[model samples]
Structures are given as C-alpha cells and as structure tokens.
Target: MSVTALYTDLSGYYDLMCADIDYREQSNYVRRLHELFGNQGKNVLDLACGTGPHLRHFIDFGYTASGVDINQPMLDIAQLRCPEAQFTQQDMSDLNMDAQMDLISCFLYSIHYNQSIATLTDCIASVHRALKPGGLFCFNAVDKSTIDNRAGIKRQLTHDQSNFSFQSNWYYSGEGEQQQLQLSIERTTNGITEHWRDQHAMVALTFAHLQQLLEPYFEVHILAHDYERIAPWENAAGNAFFVAIKH
Candidate 1:
C-alpha cells in the first residue's frame, strides 16, 4: 500500500489501536533526559514523531519542541494535539531545519522504517547534523535475533475507556538486517469489533554497526536493551535503545 493510504486508512482507529502503548512513560523518560542535561533555552527535534505524543512530554518539561514525520495524516494529528509545538511533514533522511537542536529523539523504534542500511545511516547523520555541539541523539531499533526467535506473540490489553487486543507477529531473517512486523489489532468499542493492521519493516542494526557509523559525528552509548521486558530470549527483545552525543 502507498504511504498516504497507510496513514489515511488507519487514522480513524489509530488512537484506539495504540491507546495502551504507554506513551506517557516513554515521554517521561525523555523528560528525565532533558532534566539531566538541562533543557532551559534548548530546542528538541523529534524525528519520526508520530502524532507528537512524545513531543507533548518534552513540552511539559519546558523545552521548545519541534518534530518531523513523512506521514501527513499523523502529522495533522500531532499538530492538532500539540499546537504549541511545531510539526513538519518531512522525510527523516533529508530533514532540513533552521538550526541545530539541543536534543534529537527518534522514539518507539521509529528509525526502523528506513528499509536500507544507507538510509538508516543517512537518517542518523541527518539528526547528527541537526544537533548542536554536545547535543544528544536518542533512538530505538529492533534487534533481529529477538524477532527471529519470537513471532506470533499475542497479548490482551486494556486502556482507559478502550480495550486493546493485539497479536504481534514479525518475520526476521538471520541472514541479513531486514525484518517485518505485522501488528494486527482488534478493538472492542461498545462490544463492536474494529480491526486495523499496521505493517512495518523494522530494519535491524547491531549496536556496533550504529556506533561505527556514527563514530565520526557522535559518541555513542548503548543505554539499555529490551531484556525480559517483551520476550524470552536473553538480551533479545528486539528493542535496543541508545543515546549518542554529538561532538
């Protein structure tokens, strides 16, 4: 499906499908980063910031926030939801902003949307260029090993005023750095069934791979792994979040 159609078709049930994703906790983590690094008079750039849910968290922490995403429908939701922050519909690999920001964040494994290694490196480089000296770049990626071992994972979850029942199925190839996630969600609204599907190709990049690629522009740090949080594999939950400091 076309990118526009993907976002447009799912816009109606997007919120419902993702109501239990715990964006608030993720946002709070970002706010903590801002606090640790001093966010006063600093700007934040949220790359691939879908619906700006995380952007709202940074704004609450007293940082001027801006975001960019290629999906216009999602950007529209973000703009409406967080009018105080600026949201732009732009590709992650070739984002052009006025100046470098203090912090640049690509959260929720959003960086995996880039289907190629070159594009992934370029996306990281673009964020590197968008940050000032000593600026921090944070992002998350899915570990290939975790996806290969686990697929067809289902969970029944509920949110405020809504119910989220989803099956997380993914295809991962151990031979290369390519993976696909099919998030099949069924929402119950007043006992009615509403279904939505989000197919995402989550590019897998090793910690060393990214660190080597970003060494020229950033001092990379592997913050944490998704160990025991999502799957049974030791240190293999398909999510490796890291922070890199720009020189």
Candidate 2:
C-alpha cells in the first residue's frame, strides 16, 4: 500500500498497536523537562502527533496544544481526542506555522520518520524556526551503530473478540545512513487469522552525527532514554532523549 493508505489503514489500530506504551509517564516526564528547559510558555506543538495521546495529557497539564501529522485520518481521531487543540495535516520535515511555540516534542522515536538525513536536517531547521527563543525541542532517538538486528519485541492482546499479535524490530545493514523499522501484526477472529507487515524507511546516524545536526539551531543535551529520570546519556548507550533549546 501507498504511504497515505498505509497510515490511514492502520490509524484505527494504532492506539491498540501501542497499548504497551506508557503515554502518561512520557507526557509527564516531558512536562518536567519543559519546566526545567522550556520558556515556561503554555503554547506547545507535537510533531507526528499520532492520535494525540500526548496532546491529551499536555492539555490536561494546562498547555495550549497544537499538533501536526501527515495523515488526516490520524488527525481526525486526534480532533475527537483533543477538541480544544488545533491540528494540521503537513509533513514535519517541511513544517510551517504562523504561531510560535514554547515547547515542541516528537516522541516514541517518531523523529525517524523523516526518511533521510537531508530531510532530517530540514526538520531540525523547521523546528528551530517554529520555536520561540529559549523554547525546547525534545525527542528520543537511537544510534544506528547500536541496533541489534537479532532482537525484537512481541506482544499480544485481545479486543473485540479478536486476538492481536504485534511484533517490531529495528534493522541496520552495518553501513550507510539508512535503517528500517520492520513491523508485523496478526489478527485472529473466530479461528480465521490475517497477517500484515510493513518495513518503514528511516534515516540512520550516530549520536555524534545527530548532535552535530542539532548544534547549529539549539543547545543540545543527550540524556539517557529513561522517561522517569533526568540523567546524562552514557557514551555506550544506543538510545537517548535529546533536549534542544532554540538558539
């Protein structure tokens, strides 16, 4: 399926597919980061804001939230989930906005969706343009060099009389600036089973390279990927939370 069709088709199941994610902890943790590193303004934006799960929490935390996504179907559901917040269908790499924000976030490693280093550079520039001075741009990412091709995650759930099995992994070829997110889902209802799979293209770079990309636009900090605690990222770790302040 085409990219548009792929997201539209999975929009309904996206939340279910991420049932194991602790969105509240993630949101609250970011809120804490904002309190520490942000401009203290209430206006905020979420990039690739699928289903607005984090937006809902941000709104409840007293933020005036807005979101952007490439998929209209996801935005439609997000509108229902966050009626008071604004949303637009736009490519994040080409992000444009009339309103500046104090805090901008892209969570769940969704920053990888930019597809290429050139576009990822565009995204960083766009984000800098969208933020107020002293504003924060926070997100999580993984170093391509540390990706373990043999490791993956699997989980199962039952909903609406259907059993769903979800599996996902990150794969890198031990070479250039490209990676893939391989995902598959299995649904079984009434003894009939259906399977679906997709491989998403993602840009690959080392943490040092990623830091170099953000340095021109922001004051960059690489933190350990623990949402519950604020700590520096040790050089050996694979994944990290990046907090950048607009320069």
Scored by TM-score, the top model is: 2
After superposition, the stretches of candidate 2 with alpha carbons farther than 4 Å from their true spots are 1-6
lDDT of 1 by residue, 1-247 (tens): 3123335666655665566677777766655554555334468989988888888878887778999998888889988889999888898988899888998988867787777788888887788788887888877766665565454767676665667676766667676877676777777768888877776766776656766888888876665544223222235345666767777
lDDT of 1 at 208: 64
- Tell me the lDDT of model 2 at 96: 86
* Tens digit of per-residue lDDT, candidate 2, span 8-53: 8867888988888999999999999999988879998999998999
Candidate 1 — worst ten consecutive residues by lDDT sum? 225-234
Residue 206 C-alpha lDDT in model 2? 94
RMSD of 2: 1.3
RMSD in Å for all candidates = 4.3, 1.3
Candidate 1, residue 67: lDDT: 94
